[model samples]
Every structure is written in C-alpha cells, then in structure tokens.
Target: MKPLDPRLLRRARGARVFLAASVLIGVASGVLIVVQAVLLAHGITGVVLRGSGVSGVALGLALVVAGRALLVWAQEVVAQRAAAAVKSTLRRQVLEHSLKLGPVWLSGERSSALTTLLTKGLDDLDPYFARYLPQLVLASTVPAGVIGWMATGDLIAAGTVLVTLPLIPIFMALIGWATQARSRRRQHALAVLAHHFADVVGGLTTLKLFGRAKAQESAVRRVTDQHRAASMGSLRLAFLSSFALELLASISVALVAVGVGLRLVDGKLGLETALMVLILAPEAYLPLRQVGLQFHASADGVAASEEVFRVLETPLPMRGDRTDVPDLRVSPLQLYDVTVRYTGRDEPALDGFDLELRPGEVVALTGPSGAGKSTALAVLLGFVEPERGVVVAGGSAADEFDPIEWRRQFAWVPQRPGLRLGSIADNVRLGRPTASDDEVRLALLTAGAGELALDKPVGEQGQLLSGGQQRRVALARALLTNAPVLLLDEPTAGLDPDAEAAVISGLRATGRTVLMVAHRPALIAAADRTVSVGARELVNA
Candidate 1:
C-alpha cells in the first residue's frame, strides 16, 4: 500500500465540511462510550447500594442506552456522508484532469487501469473513509485522555498503557512493509486481468472465426487463477495482520484488567475507578488498531490514484501557433523546419519537415506504412512536438498557443473510428454540441453518412454500423465542427469501391483545407498534389 495521494482527498470546499462532521461523529462517539461505561458501572452497583429511588436508576439506564445508540447512529451517518464526498469529488477531478492530458496519455496506459481506479479502487476506500478514518485523529488524542484518566486511579496503570502502546505501532509498521508489497502486486495482477479480459471480450468475434478461442480457455483460466491467488494472498496477510493486532490489543486490555483488579483488592483504587480502567482500555486502543487495519485498504486506492495523477500531470508537446486560425491579416498555419523524435528512439520521424497550409487548399500526404505519414499528421494537429524546430503561425510560437482553444479550429477522424454508447445524433453532436439539427443533417450529407442511420443507435464503438458507416459518422462529426482544417486517416480502407468513391467525392467537396493520409489511388489523383515519402526520395504523388 502507498501513502495517500493528497490530491485525491483534496476536493470541493463542501467536502471539508463533511470531514468536520465525521470528526464530530468520532468525538460524540467517544464521549457517549465513556458515559455508557460509567452508567453501567453505576447501575450494576445499583439503587440498593446507593440507597437511591427507583425512578433515578431507571432514568439513568434509559439515558445511557438511548444516548449510546443515537451517538453511534449519528457517527455512522456523518462517516458515510464524508465517504460520499471523497468518492464523488475524486471521480470528478480525475475526469476533468484527464481532458487536459489529451490522447497521448490515453494511448500509453491501459483503459482498464483507468476504469479500475475510477470504479473498484475508489469503491474500496469507502470503509476507511466512513469508519476507520476519523479515528486517525481520535486514535492519537483519545489515547492520551484514556491514559490521563487512568493515572487518577493508579499512576502505574497509566504507565503500563502508555508503554505498551508504542509496541502496537512498531509491529504495525514492520508488517506494513510486507503488506504494501503484497497489495501492490495484487493490484498489478488485477490490472492485467482487467486489461486482458477487456481485450478478449472486445475481440471475441475474431477469436471465434479463427477457431482459436477454445485454445484460449486455458490461458484465460491461468490468468483467472493468478488473480485468485493474488487475491487470497492479500486476504491471508490482511487476516493475519488483523488477528495479530487484535491479539496484542486483547493482551493490553487483559493486563490493564489484572492490574486494576489487584489495586482494587489492595484497596488502593475504588470499584468505580477499577471499572473505568476496564471500560476505557479497549476504547483507547480500538481506534488506533482499527486505523492500522484500514491503512491496508486505503493504501491500494492511494496507489491507483497516484497513477491517475501521474497521467494527468504530463504536459502536451506544442500547441497551435495563433489565437485564431483564419485571421484577416495572416495565414492560419506556417510550419518552420520541424523535427520530431520519439522518446528512447534515435530515428526521427519527421526530419526537417515543412508545410504551409492556407484556409482552403487540400494537401495529401501519401506513403508506405511507418514512413512518417501519421507522424506528419500528428505534428499538424499538435499531438506531438518537434524536438529542434519551431512552429509559428500568425506571428506567434506554437508553444505559447492554448491547444484547447486552438484545437477547436479542426476535427480529426482516424481510420478506425470508434463511437461511444448513444444515439447517432448524440455522437455527431459531440463535434459541435450547440449545432442545430439541420446543420447535423447537412454535415452528415457532406460526409456521405446515410440519412436513415442519422437517428439510429450506433451501439458501443459503433458496432451497429458497417466499417464505412463508422468512418462517415466520425467524418460527420468533423463536418459539423466546421473547422478550417480536417484530418482523415485511411478514410476509405475498409469500404467497398463505390463507398470509397463516395467518401473521396465528399472530401473533395468539403471546401476546407485537408491534410489526409491517402491509400486509395482515386483520392491521391483527386488531390491538387500529393507528397510521396519513401527511402529513395520524397516527391509529389
């Protein structure tokens, strides 16, 4: 388990108020417990011993029972509210920060890990947040109170409690090291399971067609068995830790009990004082021990959350060089000698590349696979940065421009476009959320998107549509944006010849500056010019 990621717990101002209420719950619970203990010791020594009225005895018992019950219930309610605040705010923060990280961040990490952090890891935090949490403060403060009160009875008893308490934390810390390692390993195995399971399910159709799915049964079983083993290992460690802590606590309480009884027998302490020591001893260690146990659970969430924070913290390479793409006085884009190199690789993708795109000209970049075609497109879209050169537009540096505000000037449709779960209209509206219905229809027509499928459900990742239809939906989204520049990567690869022709025709008529990666000969011929990139030489296609 890892230390808590401070950012995960820091959230909306109101969450602090919820934390305050959780603290109040702990304080109230402690006081109520102390009162209930006194009432029991008093009631057991009863009205006969005190020579008191029956009404006084009955009323005292009623107040003790009702107050304890009410205080426990109130504490639970407040703890639950605090847990809700932590979960809700952390989730919101993850999503909002994710948008800033851009596609590069998503590309590197497993989607399943992100899903786990957002769902399962955060879910596991509930117990610590609600129950064992406030005691983090109470455990320290209440123990001192417990010892102080015990000193009044017999100073030696207070000394015993104080001296033994440090041993609990010492043992806990030593065990915590092994527990943290096991928890990290367990979390990693879980992430692998989630990622593999997602991949297997997503590609189930392919596996079935190849008749290799049956062979995969053993593989899946192995992964599942690994997950189970890791889970059991974590559980075993947790249970052992809990047992050990409880055993130590029981010993401490028993020692206190024996000491108090001896003092009482010797007449050095009264019956009430001896009983108080018996009652308060557990209350003191209970919070501290519970906190140590919960530390295991909270540590997993903290580890996962820190990973999320790491992704959200990476910076984008470069941005658009201008405030506005189409200014009255200057061109939208100006690509100076640009160079881009991937980390841990010596080969540069775009070595001294150059391009100057205007408002209405369509440019085509055609090349064999891995010949820097996609890298060029990535540079234009501000997804990757050139290592040694500057990209200037409208007399401004690309680094200074805001990618969020400037990326709005274009739309992108990858060859394998994916649709989110929603209606066709909902998917298209993502391009231009404020777009009118009529505008969506026009963009659909311009992108060769079918009119009939406009209102139909696309299903998850646009499974309901043919490959061509999915591409068109993405194109329709781009069209709706009315961006000055459009990027279409392998737009016609999986289409029938007619569908390919239609896709090309729609691109030619879009009347916006396009920088597309083309494989179709028709699209290449239709372009005003094409750049061919290969080892022999770079030339016009």
Candidate 2:
C-alpha cells in the first residue's frame, strides 16, 4: 500500500482542486500564526514592561484572534470538501472498472469483500484527506513561519527550536512506519471477517441440513477474535505514538522558554523581544505535534487506500472499435471455431464449438454438465470473449461492434432469475422501461403468466411465488424486451409437467430466433434442431 499515490490526484480533477485549496488555506493559516503571536507580545509588553495602558492595544489583539479563528474554520470546510470529492471519485471509478471487467472476473472474489471495500474501506479514506493531509500542509508551512519570526527577535531561541524540531519527525517516522504495518494487518483482518460472515449466513441452511452448523460457530469465533486483536493492537500503537509526540513537543517548548527567561534576566534581551520569542516557540512545535497526532488517526484510511489503488490500477480488458452490426433477423447467427478458457483452469470451458441459428428457428444446445452450453450463450450475449474465433451475425463479426448495442438486440433469461422486491408489473418493466401497461400485460400472456395480476407484490427474491411462477415472470420480462433473439439457459428446469409444457409452448410461439441450453428430452424435442457439444466438437443430436 503506497500512501497518496500521485495517480489518484492526476486521475480526479476535482481531487486536485481540493488539495490545492487545502494548501492555500495552510499558507493563510501560517500568516495568521505570525500576526497573532506578534500582536499578543506587543500588547503584553505595553502593560507590563513599558508601563503603557492595556486599552491601546486591546482592539488589535482581539482582531488578530478573530482572524485566526476564521481561518481555522475555513480550513476545516476546505478539508471536508476535498475528502468528499476524492471518495466519490474513487468509488465511481472502482465500480465502473469492475463492471467493464465483467461478471466472470468478479465471481472469482467474495461479494462481501467487494462490498466492504467499496463502502467502509473507501469511507475510511475520509480522515486521511480531511484531517491528516491538511495538518501535514500546516506542519510544513506554520513551523517555518514561526521559526523565522523568532530568529529576528531572539536567534538563540530560534536555534533551539530548529534543533529540537528534527527529533519530533524522526521519532514520528519510526512510529508511523510501524503503525502503518499494523493498520494494514487490521484492514485485511476486517475484510476476511466480513467474507466469512457473509458465506456462513448464505450457507446456513445447508450447514444445518448437514448438522455442521455448530462446527461453523467455532470458525466464526476464531475470525472474530483475530479481528479484535488486530484492532486493539492498532489502537495501542496510536495512543503510544501520540503520547511520545506530545512529550517531545512539551520538552522542546520548555527549553525555549528557559533560554528566553535567562537572556531577559541577564538584560541582554528586551522585554518585548523575549515575550515574542516565548510566544513563537510553542507555535513552531504545535503544527508538528498536531500532524503526528492526526497521522495516527488516518493510518487505517491510508491502509485501505492501498487496496483501492490496487483495484484502480487493474488493466482493463481490450475492446474494439464500435461499429453497428447488421440485422440478425434477415440473416443467420453463426459461431466459427470459438474457444474459451477460464482463469486457473487446465481445460478450456469451450473448445472449437461451432453452430448456427437461422431466423425463425429454435436451436437447443445439449451435452454433459461441462459441455460449454452456458459458455456458448455467454458468447452470444457478449459476456465472454473467445481467444481463437469470431461470432458473426449476418456478415460482420460481433466483436467489431459495441458489445452493449449488440446485446440490446437479444433477450436473456438465466437458470435462476434475480427478482427485486416490487409489484409484478414493476419487475417486468425492468426489461423495457418505456413499455406501456398493455405491452406488459401482453408480454405476460405471451409467456403463459397472464394469470398473475399486474399489481401483485412479490416479496424479496420473489419468495411469494412458486419456482415455476418465478420462471414465468422471468419469461414475461424476456418477452417484454421485444428483442429479435431469445437466449434461455435451462428455461424449464425444476418445473412440473404442466408448468414445463406451458413454458415450452410459450417459447415455441415467441416468433424470435431461440438459442437455449437443455438436458431434458422434452425440451430437445421442441427445438427445430439440437446440437450436442462435446470436449472439442459439435455433433447433431
């Protein structure tokens, strides 16, 4: 995990503006530090050493204090804005890149871990930008400003501050490096815990059926304990580091105070000059101490950003020029020697698979479990890319056209439908948002699901409906799209004889080119032609 990668600032224009504003605010705050310190010394000397009245300089001191307060408030505002811009930009970029990588890439990782990274992990970066970064700027500018002002009044006190200042950063660097390591460990622990919890919850029913639920309890507890220990270790290091920095700042300020007092007592320094040196000495160390404290607070965010940068740096998949494909309804859809191999697998999921679907014909793909039936559908839907072949519709290769526009011409229904919590009509509307009420009802009738009312509410994941009814609703959605091609992956799976008959009948009447994967004899019988996929070739079934 690198800290504050330059690519982050360069990629997000809004983040650059936020950082620029923070630096500008830090400069203004440094100017205020000098003015406020000098005015306070002047006012104190007038009443004590010069024997002048306090009322003369009272208004000037009050104005300077007010100006300092205003600057502090403005700095916080700028810091917050900068943090928001960076977080939002990073989140959007991560999501967009993940989408472009496609589901095959995402399915390899835990969904829970991805959720945690996008939500809480990126959110942790807030403190880094809003507090730690601004303090770092102040630490660089304010200390220099304060030390330079003191040198003009008392060179001895200025030299003492300059010498002791290096010690604070030296100690900070050693502690910060250790803390960063601990913070990274804690972040990793958190992601692992989240993934374990999510997996356990999703598989709880299976575990109970196997009488292994109790066994999972120990696994969960072990992970929870590890996360707790990591968190405690990070907190302990933060507290220890903060204490060390405070102690160093206090001792350095004390030395400057002692030296100034001796010089004034010896009559070598004027009362006003000694007072100014004493005031400016603490000011020089305050920014440095504050930066050390804030660094501890932002360690977790910095560690989390390391993962964010890793995801952002992932290379995107190659894409071709966006050209419109010719209409598929007038010509045939053909796969010529297509082959696909998944990551971390010895054999290709698809190997030299070839087939053709003519207009108005139903084609059924059949074979053993790993016969690449689903992979063929994926190739047509533009989800998976083949390493050694082309998918052609009409005359042009599908890869030459924009995948999104090409996919829009086809309707797809997976083996399992993902339904949201909504009314039946609302869920179907997702297929074609501009569909009218009559179109929705007609589509439902076309898919043999007209019995389900439009306004009927389906609970989460369509739990209210039977499995066959849910399949029908998914079919209705496919019909509602009014696409020229229909791609179904095991459409009649888990259906009773009556429900399966209704689905097969509806699919035959779709009046669109159909490409489906099926293992059942009844589904194969309904297709105009059946193509059986093997390890390396396609055979007529």
Q: Write candidate 2's Cα lDDT for 420-494 as tens digits.
A: 999999999999999999999988887778889999998888988887778889989998888889999888887
Q: What lDDT score is found at residue 121 in candidate 2?
A: 90
RMSD of each: 3.1, 2.9
Model 2 ranges off by over 4 Å: 1-3, 11-13, 203-218, 258-268, 321-323
In terms of lDDT, the best-performing candidate is 2
TM-score for predicted model 2 compared with the true structure: 0.89
TM-score of each: 0.89, 0.89
Cα lDDT computed for each candidate against the true fold = 0.74, 0.84
Candidate 1 per-residue lDDT, tens place, 321-417, comes to 5455444123667666778787777988777776666667666778778777777776766778778677666777666767776677668887677
Candidate 1 at residue 396, lDDT? 72
Q: Which ten residues in a row have the lowest lDDT in candidate 1?
A: 321-330
